[model samples]
Target chain A: MTYSIIARCPHTGRFGVGTTTFSLACGRRNESLRPNVGISKSQAFYLRRIDPFVLNLLAQGYTPAHIARLLEEDDPDFEYRQFGIIDRENNVFAYTGPRIGQWAGQRVGPYYAAYGNGLAGPETVEGIVAGFMSDPDAPLEERLLRGIEGGRDAGGQRFKGQRRPERSAWLRVVDRLDWPRIDLRVDMHDRTVAELRRIFEEFKRCDAYYQECSRDPRNAKPEEVVMSELSAA
Target chain B: MTFSVIARCPRSGRFGIGSASYTMAIGAHCDGAVRPNVGVTVTQSAPLLRNNRLALNLLAQGFTPQQALRVLAENDAHYDYRQIAIVDREGAAVAHTGTHVRQACGQRVGGGFVAVGSMLANDKVLDALVAGFESQSRADLEDRLLNALEAGRDAGGLKGSKGPLPERSVALLVWGKHDYSDIDLRVDLQDGAIAALRRMYVDYKPTAEYYEERARHPRNAIPAMEFADMLKNKQKAMS
Candidate 1:
């Protein structure tokens, strides 16, 4: 039902997360952030408290493995939930519920990993994970696209299992390390995974145009108008 | 708890959405992109992923915005708590407001785009938002969303407040064929009651600096900040 990828660009020193689910758009429902500490989580499939609590634990100097232990220790019913973490130290951690589907599995990367269940097929989840790891040296955008393609090619939840056509979302975040961070999401849409891939491939360019929009005088005050409007009053 | 913006690029026929909510950053909870149709969505608050994903699917299949939204909303789980607005590839618009929303919840349907919000005050504030968008016609959807938010503030905002309603945030998104190169803004915070909302709106306005360098997604993609150069340049020229 879900597939997610969290990563760090050791070369760019940037990080990102990309995901899509057969159940719902996880990006629209989850949130996480840390200042060179670690990325946290509060996803819809799991309790919202997990997001901040994990980050808080890391902020308090808990390693990724320790934080995972803490969450598991506190929840007692850890198998019923799912979680993944990647700290600045690149220590990765994850947990999958016992009730997950056959397609569900977790992938551990040097900086991140992918976990999913209720997916279209076994190969489907594997495809997403393989795509991410296939090019460990690729840009975050390309890597994410490959992962999503992996899901789609392996027959992502499209018309399979015959569920209520659940929804899913994508999220990508990084440290803003001089280079800008990639933060994108989609809420409640069909073919969302495909769309997520397409968006990322193009954002690199469009983001530039938006950069120029801010400097245009039209965005300024009346007299300060950088460019005069041709439309008459 | 959430604030966001959606817009289309006349030059490329691309549509986008971006938002920010209380403690929930814009990129994380309410944002996505569809390349084939050149569309993006900024879903916030409860973040209705099913409906949002369904709507996009319908759009890909050539359904009009209105029909797509209707079909998607018919079976939504938390339909009563969701608010949505969409801009089709052709610039047609559609919007929906769930039943159990707050007072100020509403949407302003424009010619090719729409602005929607939830968990607010009375109808006047909503109407004022439309007025604000209209007044800022020269501005792109991002600014129009901001204008609508300003209108929301002008109409006493969240409540008929003597001061500001400090419980909100804002996000702005713009999508296009340029793909990863779109301009979006996702301001995650503010301090006062309206703290979150204001901080989101103002912080992203710098929009330019993000362009000279590379802007990432989930950090700026959900909100479309990377392509800042396009909006400022194109919209400014058109204006």
Candidate 2:
């Protein structure tokens, strides 16, 4: 019922998660992130409580593969879940449980993990990887959003000949700050991927202003002024 | 730094809040609390997360909006810097704007809704918000709330040193009978936050009922792609 890509940018060291699902609030439930540490995603019967534990394991110097093994050993419902981990060093690992659902699969690439359950076919995960790899020089957030869009284009979730819409979508990126650099969610929408992209494009226009606001509040111009300047330019 | 409207749909019994601010993450920071069948509240202008929870707790205990406001006023030491609005399940709405809040700060109460703001461009902002909401009394709760926020923004949202400030963040949250929200969309950091929020709402509107149907009656619910195909076929036949 869900498809996602978790990756760390080699250029900026930023970690991000881009995801869409047939249910509601996939953004709030599936992802866990620690700035400068790593990113983790748990789906396919996702337990929201496990995300923090995954982050903690990453903080403890556990590799992505090691963390998956530990989860398989410790969690009783591990067989029902799919996990993805990408550390700050761009080390990546992904796991798809056998009993998760039909058309479930995962694809691992350098610094990224693309995975899904109840998808239309293996092409969904393949599209995600191709999208992410298509632009190594772009910002991590853009690449992640594009990756999920590629999944949607390749045919999203499907079960028993009935295709489900990607109703909820989210994009979360964290830099070195305690807070996320970009955190956007479409909790419920027909065009989840498109809506996420629209907002991301809008946010990108003033992304610099926000960064300045966080870094130096006193000297930062109001967002309106910055926008006007950008438009004039 | 912010302006918002918290409302309940008398027709559908849904609670919704729409907010826009010059600051980042207004949805996470300024959004107070919303409980299904209880009430909705928003606290801004030096907001405190605990106050939002407290207000919701009080409303859940069957307190009126005004009474909840009084409790928040009495317990909060920095009440003078805070602005709060609450709408109960009964459609009774109330708001408090402290005297120490920034210039152009005020609030307006209409039937089933409360519009509040601090550091606004002018007093017209709240009035426009109220007018926009009341104009769409027959619309969905989410639509009405978004209309109010858009009207507020058009009337000049935040008051900057020279002119109207740009909204960096905006959010819309609507809750039906379910424990989860029917819609929870946020433009956490954007210059045209209200516009982005409106786009999200428009995109989400068509699928709202589908999700509800899926949750309530999974056996009868049509798959989203199949549903889209059906609609396309219907359109083709009509054409």
Candidate 3:
């Protein structure tokens, strides 16, 4: 009934967790971050309480597996929830509920993990992760958008029930600063993953394009720094 | 439907913007400010990048908040449907909410006090803010802002919003006038916003002052040293 994509980008000392779920109002419910502490993404079978749970675990200095095991054991339908975590240690952990719909899966990498449910198939998430990891030359956001597109192309959340299911997702990652940066979401859409790419391309150019409009000192009054929207590569 | 009014408090170099949105993400979307020359608020609409950019430009041209809003409205296609608030380098403020904007309107009560809100919220939401800002004798930007937010929420916020209605909220970009303490906080999102930004101002809070001194003059990092001492003192004092 829903599709969500979430990942962590650890740049320098910054860590951010960005995610988007096809379920209406997913952004408001499924995403959470704790500055340099760690990133926790609990969706599909979301457990809002997991936010504090993850924080407690990290505070206790528990490993990713320990927390994962706790979450899994605690939840009657452990296998149904989609959980991904990346701590200050760069360790990655992910869980897929046993009762999750078909074509759901997850994959982990050195600094991030790509998890989705009701997707086209297991290969979608796997292919996205691999493509993103292989595109070593691209900037962080580019790699993430590439990974999302790869999944969407591989038959993302199935098109059933409705004439066409609204394919919506969000992408977020922090670049080593522990600052929750790069937040973007499309509440609803029917376009293929490619169209989403074009939108993200604009986002990647100026992540804060909406707010960056006033950076120009020329944009500001005379005394302010002449800031301009200098798109990042 | 959401109604809101916004404005900037130009304190010479540092600037601050104040806005209240009927929606939960108002703090994230409707407010944006910078130190030195400009403060802006984009309310009751999708983030308008075009008007936002123009507002900054107009402010730089020495237009007061009123002038900037008039210019942006005149050239905007959705002018009637968009509401905005601005303050330039001089404490001057101006605001506009599209005429089509209903049950959603706002007005400034006193200098540096702008209240705008709508979205199932009682009109008192904004009125409370106006009263809080105008009534409170507080001079600190942060305190005033918190008071305004507190007043608005108590007047019965979304009551049953997407979430349990925020007991605690955040103000992302706050530039204090007395001291150049500018706060740029991104509560939640997408990516690089890679703009290398300055976290603190050179003259305001202790942190900024310390950093400033460390970069300039050979004087002992007075602020830095004092900060360390303060932390230690605070710890000891608590102990």
Best prediction by TM-score: 2
Tell the DockQ for candidate 2.
Answer: 0.12
Q: Can you tell me which runs of candidate 2 are displaced by over 4 Å?
A: A5-18, A21-102, A106-115, A118-168, A171-183, A186-233, B30-32, B74-77, B212-223, B229-239
Model 3 spans > 4 angstroms off:
A1-20, A29-31, A159-166, A175-179, A192-196, A204-233, B1-106, B109-239
Off by over 4 Å in 1: A23-25, A41-45, A101-103, A158-160, A163-166, A177-180, A215-233, B1-127, B130-239
lDDT of 1 at A122: 64
* Highest DockQ against the true fold, candidate: 2
**10 residues in a row with least lDDT, candidate 3 chain B:** B192-201
Please, what are the lDDT tens digits per residue for candidate 2 over residues A39-62? 888876655556768888899998
Q: TM-score of chain A for each candidate? A: 0.79, 0.90, 0.75
Extract clashing residue pairs from model 2.
Answer: none
Taking all chains together, each candidate's TM-score versus the true structure is 0.48, 0.61, 0.48
- lDDT for each residue of candidate 3 in A166-204, tens digit (9 for 90 to 100): 334555555533223554444334553453465556544
Q: Against the hidden true structure, what lDDT does model 1 obtain?
A: 0.55
TM-score of 3: 0.48
